[model samples]
Target: MAAPLSPIVALVRAADPDRFLATLFAPAAQREALFALTGFNHELARAREAASNPMAALIRLQWWRDAVEEARDGRPPRRHEVAEPLHAAIRAGLLDAADLLAMADAREAETAEEGIPSAGAFTAYLRGTAGGWSVAAGRALGVRGEALALLQRLGAAYGLGGVLRGVGRLAARGRCLLPADALAGAGLSMEAVIADPRAAAPLMRAMAEEGAARLAEARAEARRMLPRSAIAAALPAVLAAGDLRRAGDPLVVPGPRGLAARASVIMAGLRGRV
Candidate 1:
């Protein structure tokens, strides 16, 4: 039998299964670094729920920021599941500290009470978090030059699909990441979106349309330039098409995950096309 999963890997599998599956297709040696990067993202992603107040949340993020710097400086890492392996990867030169730090920096914006201010701001958030994560993973996989840049754009497109898909769940948590202008155009506030998901349908549809266009552009570009070495890094985009399609309908409940999701991932992996 295969070795049992590591704690960090298990955590990622449960929290971000899509990325977890994508990571599995990586070269065995690089999978650990990918998981460490993803696990770090998962930890940062939960900062809001991990702390009782905004200050505490910021402190938590700062703790991560310090951890990244420590990793880059060749110092002992704070003893945590994700931090340990993440620092190990950094020490091995399999990951870049700058890309990891960019992921953390973008998340600090999530602590704000107000939703995203504009479409441009929303895109920037996607660029930093998703784009940074992708390029970091791509670099770790031996991708460089224009391919690394393509990974960043593809990651942003994937993020757009994800943001649209999770709008309903986010609204339930009293958090809305929709562009303020879109919300205003729909006459909806974060509170309003939470109260009436249907009221936010128009905004969701608009976001879906945007995601489709971005994904199309990214996919065409990827076909021309994304390196095959970065297949694992880019594989997460395989699900973006289905996500964008469903995103326009907020009331549509997501079906359970089963064989189909895995099968699609497998096909994408074999084809080296995300």
Candidate 2:
């Protein structure tokens, strides 16, 4: 029988299936560490959803921030599924407390009442959250320098595509991930989009195009800079590109299509192109 998955791996597979699938491409020895990192990310990203209100969300985020600090100081992590594995990742030198803390801060920032202010702000947020996580993942995999930079770019592209693809779901909760500038450029407002999603199609299409551009840039850079071992760290690029292609449909979630997604990732891994 297959060995039972640890809590962190189970959490990752349940909460972020795409990433869980992507982790399958990683070197076997590193899979557990990668799951811990991504699972922690999933917990942070969903903190707000699990809370009853914004303040409650902040409290949850603070708990994670404190957990990271405590782990860094040699204290035992909180007795929780996510925290336990996260502490292990840190102790094993697969992750950095500072990076994880920064990610916590980014997750808190995402809980703002105001929607994204501009396209630039959206980009910054993606870089800080997704791009930052990519950096830590690369570090865990022993990637550095130029390869790390490429990973960040790929993360940003993947992040933006994810946000855009989830626009419909976010809209249901009165949340809008598209920046005000993009909305204005498309002649729509957050309120309008939330009330009627059809009004947001043009803007979503534009954001999709932007995500595609970033993916293209990251793909080109990865081909030139990333080493064979780091290819798994950049698998999100293929997933992001596929999502961008379907950005026009608000209800269409962006991810690799099951078997097709897995096949593409395998192909990319073999070719050393994320």
Candidate 3:
């Protein structure tokens, strides 16, 4: 029988993921758990957009939704391939199955939608997936109430940053995420902006700058309110998302320079030397 994937192995399968997680977390145990969580997230993300056929991708996403549900109810998973590692992370981190299910729900909704209409809808969609996921991770690390809220806020910032960065690739998928109203006000349409990649650059710069500012605020809050021990606990989650600001575009596969920078930042935090 083939060996189950170690956390590093699964995480390292994707460049950004490996760099981000490896740099931010170093406790062999926590790293393993995080690797499992991020690996599953990356899988779900790809299943939604990687394949040529949208119908097939939708089916695959549905299968994931079902697996999340089954795992939540303590039923043996229907899809072992994705379920096993995810289950391991849940156990290791005290992760709630509900948050994972919520992620699937967000993807299911996005897959069915024709396209994002405005920034509000995009924010709502991100809240369900990225925001939910970060809150869950914070909870796993034992953050509560206010701290949890802050984490969710940071996650939202990360999601918005990703959308801006990935505008080019996202437009290629027959979906556009820029707030149509916002773009209209800016005298742009999703099509026009994407068609002329340079046209989108200004908005992308604005979004990235805004996201970085929000993240900086969140990090400051964490440093103040969170216990020192837990600061390290929170560091990786924030830094992994923060690195996106420097990763060029979220949707385009990150290159070696971006990946290497991500790894360095995380490793510094992991060593308690950042």
Candidate 4:
């Protein structure tokens, strides 16, 4: 068997299986860096869940911010699995600290207990986290130009599908990310949805519509450009397509980590498309 590149793969495989599966198609030399990016993102996401309050969450986020800076400055990274590989990727010039830092900055919004305020706010979050991360991966893979932009947009669409997939889990923890306007139109509120998943039905439908539309638009645009180098970064679009189409309720779910998801990815991979 081939030797492992980094332990970050195990974490990425568990925390963000979709990205991990997608990474399999990346060049062997580039796989470690791709997982490092997703591993870093996974750790940043855990910071919110691991903290007790907003101040605590901010502190957790700050630790990552500091680690990125330390790595960029050539200083030793604070000891951590994800941080170590991320630091290496940064130093090796396979990844950019700027993009990693931007992802961390955007995650600061998770500190909000009131949930997302509007549709625009949701889009901004998607752009920063998912869009930012995919751009970082594409850059690491040497993807550039319109293909890069296409990758970023596709990432945002995947982010939306991800949010929908996690609605039940988030609500069970007293969080609701469905945009407030969409909630109002659905005659629901964040607190209500957070307390009762059923109330989110209409809002979920609206989000599903928006997510599906974005996926369609991204698919159309992708047909025009996405280069072979970007397929790994853009693979989440395949997951988003499957998830959005079969999405039921946030309180319920699809097995994106199961065989079905892998099959979808394999089919897309075989087509050399995302």
* Per-residue alpha-carbon lDDT of candidate 2 for residues 33-55, written as tens digits (9 for 90 to 100): 88988988888888988888778
Misplaced by over 4 Å in model 2 are 253-256
Per-residue lDDT of candidate 4, residues 1-274 (tens digit)? 9986457988898888888988888888888999999999898888889988888989988999999999999998778888899999999999999989999998877888777788898888888888888989999989888877788888988888888888889888888777788788778898888888877876677677878887888878776687776678888888888777756577785564778778988777667686
- TM-score: the better of candidates 3 and 4: 4
Q: In candidate 4, residue 168 scores what lDDT? A: 87
What clash count does candidate 4 reach?
A: 0
Worst 10 residues of 2 by lDDT: 248-257
For model 3 the local lDDT of residue 217 reads 82
Per-candidate TM-scores read 0.94, 0.94, 0.78, 0.94
Model 3: lDDT to the true structure: 0.61
Minimum summed lDDT over a 10-residue window in model 4 is located at: 247-256
Query: Per-residue lDDT of 16-134 in model 1, one digit per residue for the tens?
Result: 88889899888999999999999998888889768887789899999999998999999998899899999999999999999888898888767777767887888888888778788
| Candidate 4 runs further than 4 Å off | 1-5, 253-256
Give the TM-score (vs. native) of candidate 3: 0.78
Colliding residue pairs in candidate 2: none
| Every candidate's lDDT | 0.83, 0.81, 0.61, 0.84
Pairs of residues at least 3 apart in sequence or in different chains that clash in candidate 3: 23-266, 23-267, 24-266
What candidate 1 gets wrong by more than 4 Å, as runs, is 251-256
